[model samples]
Structure formats: C-alpha cells, structure tokens
Target chain A: MTGFDFPPPVMPPGVEALRAEVRAFLAQSQAEEGWRPDSDFGSDWSASFSRALGARGWIGMTWPAAYGGHERSALERYVVIEELLAAGAPVYAHWVADRQSGPLLLRFGSEAQRRAILPRIAAGGCYFAIGMSEPDSGSDLASVRTRAVRSGDGWRIDGTKVWTSNAHRSHYMIALCRTGPAGESRHEGLSQFLIDLEGDGVEVNPIVNLAGKHDFNECVFDGVTIPADRLIGREGDGWRQVTGELALERSGPERILSTFHLLAALVEAAGPAPEPRLAEAIGRLVAEFYALRAMSLAVAGRLEAGALPDVEAAIVKDMGTRFEAEVAETLRRAVPLEPVAGDRDGAGGNAPSLASALGASVLGLPSFTLRGGTNEILRSIIARGLGVR
Target chain B: MSDETLRLIEQTADDLFAAESGAARAALAKGEWPEGAWQAFAATGLAQAALPEDAGGAGLAAGLAVLRAAGRHAAPLPVAETMMATLLCHAAGMEAPPGPLALSTTAAGEDGDGSTVRRVPWARFASAVAVVGPEGTLTLRTPADVVEGANLAGEPRDDMALSGPPAAAGTLPPDTDGTLLMALARAAQLRGAMEQALAMTVRYASEREQFGRPLARFQAIQHHLAEIAGEAAASGAAVDAAAEARTPFAFAAAKARASQAAGTIARLAHQVHGAIGYTAEHDLHHWTKRLWAWRDECGNEAHWWRVLGTDAGQGGGAALWPMLVAAGTAGTDAAAAAGEGARP
Candidate 1:
C-alpha cells in the first residue's frame, strides 16, 4: 500500500466555539470598517486590519503567549485562518510572518531574533515576504545564485529575488541565500538571512501582476550587510529549514478559499429558484470546498500531532490550489465571467457584482496554481514520495 | 466496533476477494453470475453486516468498509445491494429474502397498471427487490417474467414489472432518506473502486516501460497519476467524513465529491493505461466501467449538487457559509433541517 495516510483527523469538537468566535469577530470587524470582502486574499494587504485581528489575539494564535501569542490549540488557529480566508479578509500583510516566519523563528531562530521579531509579528506590526524564488531559481531553490558571503562579523547578501510578494511594503524578508560550498549535495551550504527592507543595499522594484496590482516585486540585494544573528538557523541548514516553512505555507485554508468571494457572489447571482444547472454548479463548488476543507483540517490535525506531513501537505496544496482555480472556471461557466485588467480600484464599471467577482477571480486564477508552490513542483514532491521514479 | 473487529472484517473481505474475485471477474464481465463468490461473500456476513446489533449484523461503518471492498474487487455479486436489503429488512423487523437482492425507489401501481422500474440492479438474480418509496417500503419477489438489462459495467440491471401481491414490509420513518442512504452506499463503492483504479494505475505506471524507462519515470504520466492520487485521496476523506458524521449534508457532500472525482478518474486511469485499457481482456474496464455506472447510480453530481446548491441559493448570500457548515454536519439549523427533509 502507498505509505500516505489521511486518516480522518480526530479533532475535539470544541473548535465550533472557536469557529463561532472567528465568525463573530470577522462580522463585527468588517462591519465596523465598512470593508467589503474581496476575492484575492493573497495580495490584499491591510496592516490596520491585521492589527485589529492581532488585538483579538488571532495572529500567531497557536504560538506561545510569551511571544505575544495566545498559546491556543492548532484547531483554534485553523478556525482563525479558515474564517479569515473564507471572508477574503486582507491578510496578506501579516500573513507570511504569522503563518511561517514566526513559527520558523520560534523553532530555529536565535533567542534575540525571536524576542525582536515574534512579538512584532504577533502584534501585526511586522510583515515578511518569502525570498525563496529568484530570477533564475523558482522551484529549484538550491540553485539560487544569490550568495550571502561572510564579511566583517556579518554577511553581504547579493542576489536578486524575483516574484517576491509584498517585499516593497513588508518590513523584512527571509532570503534563502547560498552561504557556503555546494559540496556533493545540491542542497548543502545554503542559509536563510533576515533582510531588512529598508537596508542601504536593498532595492525593491515593483512587478505589476495580472490584476495590475503592485503586490509582487523584484528585490535586488547588493552587498546588503546584516549581522550574523540575522541568519536563520545554522549556515548549512537553509534547505531543511525552508522546507519546513514551505510545509507550513502549503497546507492551509487560504490555498483553497482564495475565490470564496466569487462563490458567494455566484450563489447570490443565482437568486432564489435558479435553474437546475445553476444550482448544481453552485452546489458542486460548495461540495468541493467542503471536501477540501475536511482534507485540509485533517492535514492540520496531523501537523498538530507533531508529525511533518510533507507528502500530505503536498497533496493538499496540489489539490487545494487547483480547487481554487476550478472555482473560477466553474464560476465563469456559471456566470460568464471574463478576465479584465484593472488598476486595483475595484474594476469600476457597469459590470454586475457577479461579473466583477468573476473578473477578479479570473485574474487571480493563474496565481492560484503558480503561487505558494507551483502545481508542477508539488506534484513532483508527491511523485517522489510515491516512489514513482 | 473495535479496530480488531474491523481489521478482521477487512481481512476476511480481502481473503474472500483474493480467493474468488480474481478468477470470477472474467466470468462476471461476461454477465455470468459468480455464485461461488456470492456464497463466500454472504458466508462472511458482509451481505448482512449493516443490520443493527439486535438484528444480528455489524455496524454501518464496518459494513461500509466491506462495501468498499466489494467495490475494490468489482465483485459482480450485487453485494452492495444485498447489504442494503439486509439493513432495510432488519429495519422493517422482517427476515431477509433469500439470496442476492436489488433496490428501487420507483412506485409500483397498486392495481397492476404495469408500472415497472427499469434497470433494477441484479433483478434477474436476486430473490427479492426492496421497493422503497415515500409511501412505504415494499419487498417484492423478483418476478420471473423480467427483461434483463446491463449497465456499462455489464452488471445485471434487469427491468422487473410490478406484478403479483407484494409484501408490505415496513414504512419508512419520516426522516429516513432512501436517496441519501443510496448515495452513501454508491459513494462508498465509488471510493473503493477509485482506490483500486488508482492502485492499479500506480502499479502499472511503475512497471510498464516506455522510452527505455518505466512509465513512472515520465513526468507526463507522473502528473496524471498525481492527479488520480489527489482525487482518490479527496474522495477517501469525503467518504470517511460522511461515514463518521452520518448526517444528511455529509452524505450529500460525499456523494457529490465522489461522483465528481469518478468522472475524471475513469478517463485519467484509461489515459494512463493507454490503448490496452480499451480492451475487455484487461481487468481495468471492470472497475472503470463500474465507476461510470456507480457515479450516476444513487445520485450523480447534478442530482445531489442541485439539492445542496438550491438550499444555499435559497438561503441567499449572507446565509452561504452558515448553510455550508450546517450542510456539512447535523448542525442546529431549523431551516437547513427543513431543506434536508425536502431533499429528493
């Protein structure tokens, strides 16, 4: 039998209370700000919104309270993230820091780094972007030519990271730069350095995305010197450390709930007593959402049980990302949505609310598969685990 | 039930298939009944496993596991139908009919106006057909004068015209959902069939050689297999969730998800298997064809999709997520419960 097991995760039933709390918090927060939910949760960055969430003790929920966290159960965190993603909240600003970086710092960072960063992340005042992808190295993280050479008691990082999300607006970045020799293993001798975005040698150039948004950037690191303490984990432990972070990044509700706004819109547009075809389409999307959420929650449970569900995480990412994209395609079929370039000012036009949601979803569809880890890469991970090669 | 008992059930089902299904599949494809296999399946108590403890049967989950095994083997004995019959008969506090059984919800004319259910599965072989409808549950002996029909899988789906005096077995409770129960049954079978298809495809991809290497070495085949893995895994989770919860929405979602996956899986498994999969000689068609038949049997994607979708649609935009949560479990929602009762 294949070694992968997604045994229906057994979570205590108390998470419903947490889910209720999250829903209530979101309802009150969204109403108070008069903020309508959006489809593209990945690129929607609202620092104030994140701080409000942090004040509610939602950010870094599962981490320890000593680091400005609530020290709650993993399911509670799952509820928080699940609600945020479903509501299509502006979670992008503190998303990276809260989801992976803070966790990574708690596990692998120096004491001082953890003290300086974890509380700020829990406060939603600190934001971080992943610096794994480079101009030439996308999925092939080991081939990153960006070198962090040792200098006078510090490292001079010099590499250009492309497709760096939120780097222009974020406070810091965790760049996976080569620190030492490649040796025999291609993954050897690399290191992750915490780069301050406002550092002297750093330049952030914007890359307009399909939605014509300024969420992505090309980050150039030219002799950006940082103290040795800025390096996350040991010098040669970058590959393993980053893999763990990616695992944290991959299996979450955000991957599957990106187009939830469109789903709600589709149901609303169908009105009461829709054609059988329309109702079925809406039902199918909701069904897929339910199934994927179940799977995602199971994976989360596995992670909470202190097992690294790398293969399971890959399955969730591969399936969850595709499910999000399929939501857009099915929405197109349901409401005839078209992809239109917008300057992020809500695509102002006479387009119906359904059409606007469809367009937003259509624009974000390609990123669904491309971001986090490409479907191709995640599949390779699954293939490797399946012993396909 | 303890894990040991469930493992025993799985082991017994596994041994039964290992001893019989491998040889009987060819005969089954030819529309010949596998009597030996059927006897072995019944002897193991899988056919009557769904009956309650007072009725001398295993639990629902245990029986579902066996049903999945039956599907895994593509066992052509109507084991799933027999299990359903055993449960219905037990629920009615009546003795199960002899031999195999079929199920139908089609209403029969009381005055013998020749109203008949077409494609009643295994009608020609079964001793009785349980006709469950909103009116009541009627156990009708399989009429001798029946026109035999087979689905894409060549399983016996004979048309039995309503005739003679049928036994008034029992009445369904106001909340008993024949459709949802059948949907869960078919979903379990689909999950089992898809798992086998995936296992077969993965094994084939690993062994079959192309371009001086195993087919698994090729990225194209790997991606296809990966997709199959995702669908199979997701379907498995859905089934387990529904089985664990046993709620109306859970079963509905499971059926919809499994049926949705089965549609793509049949094609992808064949695509991975290439031209050889098209032939009847290969064992792949038995499962794939069964998937095709099973996907539409209890409730296809459209049937159950619209059921849950109309509920969400009727609830309007603000009620969407809450409706989803309520639909996923037997949550405290009077409106959603009302919707569940009204589902066909």
Candidate 2:
C-alpha cells in the first residue's frame, strides 16, 4: 500500500555466459589494440571498435531483426552495455545512436526514416547528437527557443544547440525546435526535427572540455531545410517525445558505471595486501556499487517488461552520478598520491595508470552531473514524478 | 507464489497491523509487553511465516511480507524475530515459546571477553532470547540480568547478560550466524519504516498548503520529496533483493544500503513536512524514529559496509563485479534464473 513497487531485478537466463563472452571479447580487443581501459566510456570514441561491437550484433541489440538488430532481450542488451561500460569500451562512436536515437526513430519516426537510418545505426556506421539542451535551456528543456518554421515542402530550422556531445562527428542531430507558439503551457507547441550535420547552413564549433577533449560541440543551424519526413512523432509532440527520450538517455549502466574503471583500478592498485583503512574504503565502495547496481538493474528489468521507470531511472542517475564522483573522493582519502597531470602515453609522472584514470574522472566530474540533466533538474523531475509538483 | 497468495498475506497483515498498532504503541511506550498485540499478530500465523511449508510455516517471502506490513504501521510485533525464533526452535526440535521474542546478535567487544550480545531487541519483554555468543548458538529461556535500554523509537533493546552456558539441550544448526539474521531482519524493518515515511510525506505534501498552494506545488519542496523518494526507492529495492535472495552478500549489501538511506530519508521527510513533522502528535516521528533506531540496531551502515567491502575489495576490481552478480546465485540454472528471473 505504501512503496515504490520496484520488482526485484532478475536478468535473463545465462547472462553470465554472455558476461564471460563479453569479458573475453574486451580482453582480446584491448590486447590486440594495445589500448588502456578508459574511465569514461561514453565520452571516448572509436569508430573501429564501435563497428567491431556492431559486427558482433552487440549494438542496437534489442531492435527487431528486420532493422539489422539481433532481436535479443533488453536484459541481454543490458548485459552487453554494462560490460562495455565496465571495461571502458570506446563506445562513443555509436553510444548516442545505440542508446536513444535508434529507439526514438523506431518508436516515433516514419517508416521511411526507420528504413533509411535504423540499419546504419544498427551497423554502428552512423552517429547522432541530442539537441535537447540549448545555451539558454539546460534542464529547462521546454524553454528551447530554436525555431523550425514551415518552408516549401520542408522546414527551415534556425537555432544554436550547446553542450551537444559528438555533434561535430555525428551524422544527424535530433534537434528539439519550436514549430509553433508557446501557449499557456510551455510544454506544448514544440517539435523534434532530424537535422543533418552536413546540411547547408549548419556550423559545428568545438567546445573543449576540462578534460581537454573535443567531443562537446556547439552547433548553429541557420535556416537549414529538412524534409517533412524528418519530423519525429508529430507536431506539438516534441515535449512528450523528448521527455521519454531523456528517460532513455539518463538511465542505463553508463550513468552508474562511467567512472567504474577508476574503482576497478583502485582495487587492482590496492592489491591483496591493503591496509585496514584502504580495505575499508574498498569494501564501502563495493557494497554501495552492488546496491546501486541492484537498483539500476531493476529499472532495466522494468523496462524489459514494457514499463517506463522514469522516476526510478532518475533515482539511479542522481544516486549513481554522486557515486561516480565519490570514486575520486574515495581515492583521494584511501590512497596516497597527488594527481599529477596524466599524459596520454601513461608516462612522465610516477602516478599509476590508476592515477591517470582517477585524473580523467576528476576532470570530467562537473559534466557527470550536468550532462544527463543537472542534479537539481533531476530532483525536480523526480519530485514531479512523485506527484509532489 | 501466486498473486492471490501474496495479496492475501499483504491484505491480512495490513489489516491486523492497522487494527492493533495504536494499542501496541501504548504498551510499548510504557515498556510493557503488548500481550494482546502479540496474540493478534500470532493469530495471523506470522510467527511461523518463515518456517518451511511442510513445517506449518508460511515460508520466507510470506514472513517478510508480514514484517513489512507490521513495520509500515509501527505495530511493535517483532515479526521478524518471532519468525526467526520459530524457525530456530523448529530446526533444533524444541518447543517454541509463545509471546514476544528477542534476538541478540552483536559480538562481545574486546573490553570483556564474555559470552554475550549487548542491546538485544525486546530483551526485557522477550519470553526467551535467541543468542549467538562466543560459546555457540543457543536460546536462553530465562535471562539472569537485563539492563533496561530502549532504542530511539522507545522499543526495548535491553542488554541481557548470559550468566550460564546453553541448556545443552537443542543446539542451533552450525550454519546459522545470529549477526547476519539480525541484519536481514533489521533491514526488512527499515524498508517498511521508510515506506511509511515516504507515504506520510507524500500525503502531507499533497494536503498541506502554503502560499495558496499545496506544499507539493513548490519546486523546492518537490525536490525534497524527490530526495526522499530516491532514498526510499533505493532502500526498498535493496531490502527486497535481500529478502528474496537471503544470501550473505545480498543481505549485507541490503543492510548497508538501507541503513545509508535512513539518515537522509528521516532528515528530508522532516524538512519537507516543516516543523509540524517534529511533533509527537503528528505520527511522522514514529516511522522516522524507528528508521533511526533500526538502521543502527542489527548492523549499521558502517558495519555492513565493511562486511561487504572487505571481501569485495580483497577480490580486487576484476572479481568484485562477478562476486556481486554471484551474491544470491545458486548453481548454474538457478544462478541464471536469478540472473534472468527472480529469486532461485
């Protein structure tokens, strides 16, 4: 009578074998490519590796077979992505497409859109960027001022999208723009347009991050025309479509396991002969990690059963991002090493590769809470879901 | 395991809990045994809820449901303790005693190497005490000395000193560790209490208004409610996982996570409800106080965190994930089912 009815998580049968299979593939790939495990998987891009995973039917795994998908269960998809994130796979190339765009297209795009783009996504040959966040509207997504007015048999879009990850490299952008006037409710009158990054009058400017990465971008659309078929769902439906899309974007093992490589590296660095203090910190992190995993996995389980666990997903992100940030905090107190600037070659400074991993995580901490909806915005969303607002 | 069966258990427990909790609270506040309350609870067969079906017990899942229901109402029924006591009695082939039960699970500190566990729940009121001492697992029928103490919720958590050894009568199974069982029981109670707090907070936010609107309409207030929701949601999920699985790892993690949520949930619920939630007449403190007490009772967050953390930490990062995934796992298929389905 009084509780959030989160069904206890139970993955599909034999996910461990799938787990082992993934672990083996990651190890083999890491060995063959001589790449170090990265702390942030979603931020790091690799076209070859994304293609490799796609070839294995690991990307877009849950879609129907007609769309070049493996038609596996959501649980199976959960297992693969969790493994990919845990091992710090360079999944950025296909991360956005595989995570939300493909699903959105399948659910709301026209048959023509699905046929044209879904297979490319399934093949990991395409990349996409979320255009929900603008320079003016971060968490206040409904306040997006980007306009897409009517044109001859198409629409002309003019807006600037900020903090758009992978926008420069992405093939398309699912931009939420205003097609109509903002009425009494701010949520109404918005529409989602599929904008091509290569279209005329489109400019992508690099927004360098604290971590010295060029993944984040600011894209300006100047009267770029997109055909009517590019509209996702219907007119005046972008708010609902994007809200659901945000849920898909925010939830996932990625949010929780983004900094997992650092935690894993901490365990390895501490070794079996850890001091009491070190041991306690390790133990604490592990316990919390398991609990967070249980909660996150429950969300996935609910998703698989055809329920949208938006609040549950928000909880995961809120708790999960804090935990992700805590890894660095825990490392600082538990271990004794000043975080020197990490070189790309894993050398120069005497800091362990673990230190470099920690360094990378620390530099990206600000974005962890900011990117997938700010923490404050997430709390408001959670509150609304609780029927409080 | 059918929906009807679980529904029956939930409805019956909720009804009994609602009916008896006020009277039970009066007796508990006076530090007296609520005989009528215990009888009403026992009448539901929750005392034997965790016993195997063939043993005339309702099984673990049903027992947890009963505990959760009692916890939601703050019924002071000792549902978890009674079920555990009955299971132990049934296992050891002893006649189980009637009335209020208690369990002492904490290990004796290094200060005095005595065979005892301090702060045993309901020790003064218990007919018998199920204990895991330095000697071995045993239940003392008559406690020699009980230094009276109460947790933050006013429930008796007396320090029962065991003067003599076990009766040498029925010995508990070797596999039983009182501390772990206590963790499981306390976590279940915390889960129930948090649910009550969440429900109360939501209702209060929806009804109480300021500035010509319900408190729920305020963005800041909604944020606080959301915080509590997140805590309660995570705590509930973890506790359910522990209850359904009943593994050492699962139980430990559940206790740690639930305990961790307690501090924030109690604080924010009070914050959202404003000053009114602090009063004794409001009934909000009842659940929050219980959450405070139960979180630190069997094993606090720190205790269980270390329990899970050390084992997992020693395994290093590579082994940690597998260990977690393997927590409630049995052999191949059951593990996979737990992987793919619910508790095996």
Model 1: docking quality category:
medium
DockQ of 1: 0.58
Query: Looking at model 1 chain B, which ten-residue stretch has the lowest summed lDDT?
Result: B335-344
Q: Give the range of the ten consecutive residues with the poorest summed lDDT in model 2 chain B.
A: B335-344
TM-score winner: 2
Tens-digit per-residue lDDT, A1-389, candidate 1: 55354656665677788788888888887777755577456746788998998898898888888888888877678877877877867788899999899999999998898889899999989999999999899888889999988899988888799999898888898899998888887989888888888765689999998677788899988878888789888989999999999999887778778887777877887898989888888888888888887888888888788877888888888888877787778777776645544434354432335655666677777888888889999998887787787
lDDT value, residue B268 of candidate 2: 88
lDDT of 1 by residue, B1-344 (tens): 67788778877886787688876776776667788888877777777676555456666667778878878888777777777766666555567777888877431221123466667778887878877655545465655677887888888777777777675556554455555666787888898899889889988899899889999999988888888888888887887777666666777888899999998989999998999988978889989998998888776788888987887787787678777765554344322111123222
Checking candidate 2 for backbone clashes, the offending pairs are A11-B339, A11-B340, A12-B340, A283-B309
What is the lDDT for B38 in model 1? Answer: 80
* Residues forming the 10-long window of minimal summed lDDT in candidate 2 chain A: A345-354
TM-score of 2: 0.93
Stretches of candidate 2 exceeding 4 Å from the true structure: A1-3, A199-201, A344-352, B91-95, B107-116, B134-136, B164-175, B328-344
The lDDT per prediction is: 0.78, 0.77
